[model samples]
Target chain A: MNYGLRRVLPFFALILICGCAAKTMVVLVPDPDGKTGRISVSNQAGSVAIESPNQATTVSSGKPPTPPVAMEKETIAALFSEALSIQPKRPVHFILYFEKDTALTPDSLKQIADIIAAIRERASTDISVVGHTDSVGSREYNMNLSRNRAASVRDILVKQGVDANSITTTSHGKENPLVPTEDNVSEPRNRRVEVVVR
Target chain B: MKAITILVTVTILILGGSVACLAALDYVGIVKTIAGEVVIVRNAQTIKAEANTKLLKGDLVRTGPNGKVGLIFEDDTVVSMGSNSKIMIEQFLFQPAEKKLSFIARIFQGTASFLSGQLAKLAPNLVYIETPQATIGMRGTHLLVKVD
Candidate 1:
């Protein structure tokens, strides 16, 4: 009986410790557009406090906390590291333009090396290729052209050893233009494909 | 003498197993990228940060003037830090099968970006990033924050 009790005691202690353990997980993802953002915190129990170079506040239960506050680039990096215990990874973005009505261009071809290098740096990642077109063609025609452009880029990445399954391709056609223009207009910047590696 | 030696061996094995289990439960994320000068403060010791570095709860990460680093949590969340910044990870718990998740961290100074993953999609409020002056609640897919 003595030996049995000794063995059982450790298991019981383990169960108790596991049941009582409470941990907090924090995740800080950057804005894809690299713009200033805000964060808001409220205390559910005890007191949640925040202190920044510009201001400080303590939030108690049952009262409204401070309003959503915008942060600068340096401030965001510091706060994010503090909360997540890890540094955020820089996101890689690329824009490649298409020729008059096709999904190929000299400038876009030049960007292939940069895109491949970015994807190879990470062990595993997700790639987004969004195709766009100028307002020089009909909506249906533009949509098809944009999709073909995105597919063309995806093919190139896959050929360069990026996993095809990790790539997602979509088309915005003329709906979302980098440089908005009137109908039947040809904007060089608008007819492009944007790639994001995360 | 033989019996005494056997008993001592059994005791050591039991203790070692428990220690290993505890260490396994403490890991929350791993360093995916590091550039320039980055370091981590853990248990009062400062260690240089590098790729594939394992990060635990209660760890403080700081970067120098040219330092930059990236970290990915178990739940696929990504965080990248810029130079001249500091951050503290207070607590992290992710168990998707059981629907249990919570993340809390504080940024003392500097700039950082965050990309939400499974935890935020499963339950957004469970993840919290705090600054010296304000607390950030994520309502979107990506966020860039700076304290000073």
Candidate 2:
């Protein structure tokens, strides 16, 4: 019996050691919209190496040896098939349209309560407020108008107890339209502010 | 007789200690939502999933005919699995300060949606989702994967 136990003990030990040596692998996929994605991997024993398109990296042990590195991708998919775990949290988005040449519409004003409620429900601190405009205005004019709209929404969110630093505001102007229109066209949905709560 | 009992007790204690240590270091994430019936299998043990149920690396998640499950990673990535689905978290590593980011998952069957987070935003090339038929490398912020 003792001899049998000794043989089994060594087998269990071998199993444990092999399991501990499993390496973590990361697979990169480019974004479909022609945007680039980037990633860098380094370890204590090796210098940092960044992955190019359709590349993979392996990290031994669990601890990372250095700080984050950036890479470029066209369509990005980061797959860490080892050494990590995940849970799911659905993100919420709100689109508030503006009146002609104005920052906020009455309909959008009423939606503020809903936006605030959604933000509070998720208890998320990171939020994005992006503004847009119809093609009715000049490029320069639309840019400034979009910025003003986003800033206004950011201010309201701050007043509703969201952290000022957590909200990032940007303007797409007439570049990315929800409803693509000809020049100088008036599309209500095109002139809007989009709020994404992450 | 007394010596034999003591030997057996010591062996049991050692085995239990090893298991406890493994559990302590194996935490990955928690179940954020569940509908219908969902089960998680890890370390050869299966359990019904509920909100806040902890998940570990190399876990197998399955849903019943009308089930759904959602999970959020430490890196803020979200994964939602639909009914009659089976998925495995093959790997995940997110340490921003150290610049370590990777996410890989395999879908055996059913539908799943992935939303990129800080890791994918920072290092897009490190994320991948695999299916029996094909492997998807995500460069976009969100992807919906379905497997028959």
Candidate 3:
């Protein structure tokens, strides 16, 4: 028994060495019917066909194939190159302001309502509405005017079938300006609201 | 007076021409891998790549170096890399206005996992993965990418 075991040791060692030198190629594929399958091919001097439920397929060879590995590396490099091409642009800010007529007329109200409706339509989760005005009358008067403008638009939106709850309002009475002009000059454009959506 | 007018016209033309050329070369922006390096890349089922190659969206990237690659998508989703592995970013598109993002990656070598963000929550199909031979649609919270 000892003599037989010693004779078989060389054969087992040779098999282990050959297996370590073998290279395998695997391809992962999805099943059409949602079942897993695999097919394996060898780079050795032999070809073997396999059918498995898993879609993963592996081809093993008795010796490692330098050419195929080199090719795979090239393919992966191309993919990396392609993924690096798409990028994002810098954010741009565009400001829009509303004007206050000498007195609120039907046309003016309609325009205000239209602007509010547009803002409501475009209001995303991060929407903000800030009302402002030109330095006119008194500080209190300007503040009231700004608040009223914001509230007025909010009211119009509610009447136009918008969710008033989603809208937030703030007043910046004469703090910001579209154009720097003298007081009481009726800077109509400054009596307005700014809407931002992110 | 005529010579002065001609000189002014020539200067305007030169300035305008240069401005136009520079504008043409202006970069909109580039989406690229913030942390990963491409150890292996090929083309159309072929092997071999040109030197100094650049990667773009939809390109598959397999990295080895203890899988230390990292990537940050436009939507702020972060992906950590693995060692002796392959990860392919299948698709990535970030449009903040519509809150739309598309992202996909595949792994072929070692192990990899992903964390979801705007791309995953907004558009589920945007993220995908592949293993030794399987294309995995990312639906689970987290996954392990490995090839046995």
lDDT winner among the candidates? 1
Instruction: By DockQ, rank the candidates, best first.
Output: 1, 2, 3
lDDT of 2 by residue, B57-143 (tens): 799999898788887665567787777878898988865534667888887876576666666776777787765534455554554
Native-referenced DockQ of model 1 = 0.12
Assess the local accuracy of residue A181 in candidate 1 as a C-alpha lDDT between 0 and 100: 83
Q: Which lDDT value does model 3 have at A63?
A: 35
Residues A1-198, model 2: lDDT tens digits: 697786565445333322444343343444334443544444445433333444434344444422322222311122221111233445567899888665578988999999888877876555779888999879989999888989988998889888897676878888768888899998998989989775
* Candidate 1 CAPRI category: incorrect
TM-score of each: 0.46, 0.43, 0.32
Candidate 3 stretches greater than 4 Å from native: A1-198, B1-55, B65-67
Q: Each candidate's chain A: what TM-score? A: 0.65, 0.57, 0.42
Give the candidate number with the greatest TM-score.
1
Per-candidate RMSD, Å: 18.6, 19.3, 19.2
Q: Residue-wise lDDT of candidate 1 within B30-122, one digit each (tens)?
A: 778778899999989999988867789899999898888888776667877778978898878875534668887787866676776657767
State the iRMSD of every prediction, in order shown.
10.0, 11.2, 13.5
Docking class of 3: incorrect
Off by over 4 Å in 2: A1-198, B1-23
- How well does candidate 2 score on lDDT at residue A99? 81
True interface contacts retained by model 2? 0.10
